[model samples]
Target: MSVLYALAGLLIIAAVVSLVLSLLGVIVVGALRILPVVFVVLAAVFFLSGGRIDVHLPDKWRRK
Candidate 1:
């Protein structure tokens, strides 16, 4: 009976971990999907602001 209880606890732990991981994966994917749109909007705002917005992006994101 003790071993069975231990196994049940392990199963519950595994299920919880899996649920958390899946939620994280979903959030990451959702952010990635919206990233391009975010960038576009930022770019628009930057240009409209005449470089006053200060996006502070990486150098690679800048055009030569």
Candidate 2:
């Protein structure tokens, strides 16, 4: 009947919406989990390069 068709259509639409939301949620969570790792890597690099936060200039930029 017409009511059955409407219900089926609604169900399909809901399923699609749920799928999209779940995918986005997964992507966001994955990025959040990696954020700490990225920060740790940055800290390691900074410490390895010495305590100074200044940038090293290239030969062309340095005055004689």
Candidate 3:
């Protein structure tokens, strides 16, 4: 639990630093760089919450 908190804190700090650096124009932040991080953060939150996302589709889409 402590480790998880520590990791989450570090991620927050890193995000803050990245935002600051982006504002400073020291580095260019683009979708390519942003997406994986967003995915990772969302996945982590979802995993910690033990939540499931269910997608419903039409029967046509379910068939090959």
Candidate 4:
């Protein structure tokens, strides 16, 4: 009975860890998948506007 309890605890821990890992993996994969689309859209906007767009960033960002 003690061994069964231990096994159950381990399984629960493993499931939690796997769930967290899968969530992180999904976020990373989603970001990677969307990156190309984002770039393409940005490029299209830039080209369509004849490169006349001005991007303004905050001072903190400008410092970086």
Quick one: best TM-score, which candidate?
1
Candidate numbers, best lDDT first, in rank order = 2, 1, 4, 3
Worst 10 residues of 3 by lDDT: 24-33
Per-model TM against the reference: 0.78, 0.61, 0.40, 0.57
Candidate 2 residue lDDT tens string, 5-53: 9999999999999999999999999999999999999999989988677
Query: What is the per-residue lDDT of model 1 for residues 1-64, given as tens digits with 9 covering 90 to 100?
Result: 9999999999999999999999999999999999999999999998888885455789998899
Tell me which of candidates 2 and 3 scores higher on TM-score: 2
TM-score of 4: 0.57
Residue 14, candidate 1: alpha-carbon lDDT? 100
lDDT of 3 by residue, 1-64 (tens): 9999999999999999999987767445566678899999999999899988898899988857
Candidate lDDT (C-alpha), each: 0.95, 0.95, 0.87, 0.95
Distance from true location, Cα of 14 in model 4, Å: 0.5
Candidate 2, after superposition: displacement of residue 38 in Å? 2.1
Residue-level lDDT tens digits of model 4 in 1-64: 9999999999999999999999999999999999999999999999998887688888887653
Better of 1 and 2 by lDDT: 2
Task: Name the lDDT of candidate 2.
Answer: 0.95
| Model 3, TM vs. native | 0.40
Better of 3 and 4 by TM-score: 4
